[model samples]
Target chain A: MSALRLIARDLRLAWTGGGLWLPILFFLAVAILYPFAVGPDAKLLRATGGAMLWIAALLAALLPIERLIRPDWESGFLDQLAVRGWADEAVAALKIAAHWLSFGPPLLLATLVGAALFDLDGDMAGTLLGGLAIATPALAALSVTIAALTARAGGGAAGLMLLPLAIPVLIFGAGSLGPNSVGAMPLLAAVSLGLTVLAPFAAGAAMRALRD
Target chain B: MEQRQAEPAPDAVVIDRLACLRGGRLVFERLDWRIARGTLGLLTGPNGAGKSTLLRIIAGLLRPAAGSIMVEGRVALADERRALDPLPTLRQGLRFWAAMDAQPATATDRVLESLGLAPLADVPVRMLSTGQTKRAVVARALQSGADIMLLDEPMNGLDKASAALMAAALAAQVRAGTTLVLASHIPIGIDPTTTLDMAI
Candidate 1:
């Protein structure tokens, strides 16, 4: 019951706090800019669009990183919940789930616009959608972990820490869209699942460390 | 009030040889104290003293470098930070904690009334004055129905009437068998049964 309420609170905060539109807007901005940057050649746009979308999705996930855990930490919400018999791990897991819910689906919908803008064919579009579906949770997990790690120090350290760790996800995610890259999809799924499982523990440890 | 399983000890908290270290400096060492249930226990100290640190240790939010604390009941804390969603209405913010604490729906109203914040229920938390925000944090702690509340500077920003209200509400909690470990720099109205002076 408390778990659901926690998720509800997070969703409410995300929607009402005005960051819900940020990632979507940023995603579309990248989508709109990519074609202009590459010139309006349909073949070039289609060739590079999937990779561009992957980059956009990754960057979109990064947009809200600062707001993720810092506010709750500063406001003493985390301490209050701890006193209420909540484990840091459980809180972190719930946050990751909530973060993904707030981030993943909206970006997925925005991807449709990006896909259309890029004039992606059926096969490429399907690959793009599938790759994102498997990848965004991992992206969400990464963002949350980075948020916890740098919740105190601010955004500079977060970018420095997150970008390096995110290389694997980015590699496999973009690789899946390459022609005849049958093995890349499973690798992406594998890496993503591993991150999703480990992120809660990492983020939880960061919060606990912060308490000292 | 929600019923709790009967505790064996008359004391809600027992601190033995407690020590705290922050930033590689010893904040306090070998501190010993007992906070009896159904009484107000005051933690009074000068600035840079460890009153807030002791409360955090008692609340289990911070680890003590040495010694152990045995807390006998559910604990709640209302510190300098409001610990609430600033965007939500005061009532909505309190209701979230109430729900988390597993208190009934009516608990929010009752707590607000006790804290003299009923009129501010519909106001957004960010719009509240300093004292109102302090009262709201107290309201959140009180709504939890915890047997022990560790409040850091509960009366910090209150004016005379609001301070009186806060004192009255805390006294009422003591009368109802709730234990409070309060850290305040100012002398408060309620007569604390025991006072731990950390400055020494």
Candidate 2:
């Protein structure tokens, strides 16, 4: 019950804090601006637009990184929850789940509009959606871990820290866009699964380390 | 109220040969204390004397340089930071933790009434003055329903009347069998069964 309540609180915070809109707008802006930059050729836009959306999604994930874990940590909310017998891992897991909820769906929905702007056909759009389904959770997990690590340092440092870690998800997710991309799905799921499994523990440990 | 619905077990806090280090300097060493159920512990020390550090260690927020802490039952801490979300109204902020603690919503109302905060319950925490924020933190600690409470410098910004009100509420908690460990430089106005005085 408390876990649900915590997730609800996080979702509300994310919604009201502009967690949803910023990323969607950023994603759409990239799609809208790309056609002008590269030219009005529909075929070229169709070819590269999916990859561009992946990049935009990756950058959009960075927008919430700074506020994701730090405010609660600094405000003592995490410590308060700790003393209440809520394990850091549970808290980390819930925050990751909530982070994904706040960003993942909206970004996916925005991608449909992005697909239209980029003139992607049915097959490419389907592939883009599948890749995002596996990839965004991984992005959220990596961003959250980085958020925990640099929560105390508090600056663009977390953004810098997140870029390298996020590269794997980006590479695999974008790589999956090819003709034999079915093969890339499992590998994409593998990387996402690995990060998802490791993130809670890693982020939990980072939260504990903040006390020292 | 109603003897706090009975704890799962008798509560106790034991710290042995505790030592603390901050900023590469030894803050204190060889500290020892025990607080049993229904007791009020006063942690008194000069500034920079490690009172807050000891409370943090006891609250499990910090690791002691060397020591052992054995605590029975759930613990809650209230320090300089208000912990409650600043964007929410006082009532809303307190309710978040109340829900987290699995307490009914009325638990928050009871705490607010006790802390003289019912009138300002709709005020956003960020807009609250220092004294009001302190009261809000106390309200949160009281609503936690934990077996043990660790309070660090809880009286720092409270006015005399508010301090007296806080003292009364704490005394009531102690009467209801909640073990309290309070660290403060000012007089807490409640009789403490155990006092740990630290020196720099």
Candidate 3:
């Protein structure tokens, strides 16, 4: 019951604070500009658009990381939560869920714009959306873990730290779109499940360390 | 006081030779104090005397370098930070915590009224002046309904009237069996059961 309220509060704040828009804009900008950068070769756009979208999604995930945990830490909201006897792991897990809710579906919806821009055939677009659906939980998990780690020392290096961790998701998500990749989707889901399960513990430990 | 520490009541906070180290220096050591239930305990010391550190330790937010503290009940804290959401109106910001604390719908208004924040309940938290923000912090701690409140400078930045209101509210809590250990450089307008001078 308390956990649901926490998530609702986070979502309400994210919506009201305009935290959802910047990353969506960044994602769309990448989609809109990719053809301009590489020149409008229709065949090339079809082949590489899925991979480009994956990269754009990964980068877009970073836009909201700085504010994810730092604001609560600075404002002493986390301390109050801690005083309520909330385990850090529980809080982190709920935050991951909230972050994904606020970021993932919107990013997928925005993919329609990207798909149109890239002139992606329906099959490729379907695969990209499916892949993001599976991969976004992992992306949300990774973003939150990094946010908790850097929340105390400062968030300046969160972006730099996030890219390396995002590689596995990118590999499996983008790889699943290849024509001959028979079993890649399951592998992507497996990785996402592991990350989604493990990230809360990692973030929880980081938050405990921050208390000292 | 030392004798009371020797034989602490079950519903009391007993610190036994507590020692704290912060930033590689020993803040305090071999400290002993006992705060019985319903007692108003005051912590007074000059700046850098580790008063805030001691409060955090009691609240279980910090680990002491040595020794132990046994607290009888759940704890809450109200420090310099208001901890309320800045974007929301004061009432909405507090309702979130009220929900978190499992308080009823009426609790937010009740605390706001007690703190004399009823008028500014519609104001965004970020726009509140320092004194109003201080009261809001207390309002939050009050709303938690914790048995023990470890407040750091709860009276700072308050005008005489607000300070008196705060003191009265805190006294009422104490009378109702909520233990309070507050650190303040100035008098909080309540007669404390015991005052621990950290500078010693």
Top model by lDDT, which number?
Answer: 1
CA lDDT, every model vs. true structure: 0.90, 0.88, 0.89
RMSD of candidates 1 onward, in order: 2.6, 3.3, 2.8
Q: What CAPRI class is candidate 2?
A: medium
Query: Per-residue alpha-carbon lDDT of model 2 for A23-129, expressed as tens digits?
Result: 99999999989998999998898889999999999888878887889998888888888877788988999999999999999999999999888878998899899
Model 2 over residues B24-79: C-alpha lDDT tens digits? 99998888898878799999988989888888888887888898888878888998
Top model number, DockQ: 1
Candidate 1 deviant stretches above 4 angstroms: B1-9
Q: For candidate 3, lDDT tens digit of each residue in A8-112?
A: 988987888776887799999998898899988999998999899999999888888877898988898888888788899999999999999999999999888
**lDDT for each residue of candidate 3 in B135-193, tens digit (9 for 90 to 100):** 99988888888889888999999999999899988998888888999999898899999
Candidate 3 structure, TM-score to reference: 0.96
Off by over 4 Å in 3: B1-9
Regions more than 4 Å wrong, model 2 = A180-182, B1-11
